[model samples]
Target: MIEIYTDGASSGNPGPGGYGVVLKAGKHYKELSGGFRKTTNNRMELLAVIKGLEALKTPSHVTIWSDSKYVVDAVEKKWVFGWVKKEFKGKKNKDLWIEFLKLYKIHQIKFVWIKGHNNHPENERCDQLAVAASKDKANIGIDHFYESEQAKETLF
Candidate 1:
């Protein structure tokens, strides 16, 4: 069984943000993280899970631990599927969601929610990684969809 721990952070609601993931399969462990210049915390949260799953080279039984209720609850509660059935219209993070669904179908995934900042070692480490990445301006990349959406909103 593969266990993945994830966390996401944002300096501002719509500011620099990043996601952190820790994947462990037996004794092997891996950490992944990236930042975006402009994005919401929720996007980062969802992206963390997506990245973890994407990193897997083959289908496997996977359990995802996330501090984001938005990500965990959405899947555990089946809200994401409802949105998908509606074609994701009027939904935020449609791009990421679409990508998530693609990889998601390739593996058996389980979502678990862990309370944030509760002294959980792995979760704390993930939070630290996410915060550090969010503050690293040099390595951060543009969140294209978010930037384009902002541009479109400003034009009207």
Candidate 2:
């Protein structure tokens, strides 16, 4: 089984954001992280899981560890399925959710929620990666969908 630990951070609700993911299987391990010029913590949280799953080269049983209830409960509690049936109307991060579901269907996945900043070793490492990525201006990427949506919101 593959185990993935993930975390996300943002300087502001819609400010600089990043996600960190640590993937472990048997003796193999990998870390993944990236920063966005403007995004939300919740987006980063979900994206961390997405990135972890995406990195897998084949289908397998996977356990995802996350510190965000927004990411965990939505899957564990089946809220995302309901949102899907409704075509994701009134939902935030539709782009990411759709992408996640596509990858999710290709593998067996489980989610475990943990308290943030609680001193868990893997979680702490993920948090550190996420925070550092968010602060890395040189390598920051753009969340085009998010930025465009925000631009539209400001026009109304």
Query: In model 2, what lDDT does residue 102 have?
Result: 99
User: Residues 80-133, candidate 2, lDDT per residue (tens digit)?
Assistant: 999999999999999999999999999999999999999999999999999999
Poorest lDDT segment (10 consecutive residues) of candidate 2: 128-137
Cα displacement (angstroms), candidate 2, residue 71, comes to 0.8
Question: Model 2 segments beyond 4 Å from truth?
Answer: none
Please list the C-alpha lDDT of all candidates, in the order they appear.
0.93, 0.96
Worst 10-residue lDDT window for candidate 1 reads 71-80
lDDT of 2: 0.96
Per-candidate TM-score against the hidden true structure: 0.97, 0.99
Pairs that collide, model 2: none
The runs of at least 3 residues in candidate 1 whose Cα sits more than 4 Å from the true structure, single-residue gaps closed, are none
lDDT of 1 by residue, 63-155 (tens): 999999998988889999999999998889999999998988999999889999999998998999899889898999899998999899899
Residue 100 shift from truth in candidate 1, angstroms: 0.6
TM-score of 2: 0.99
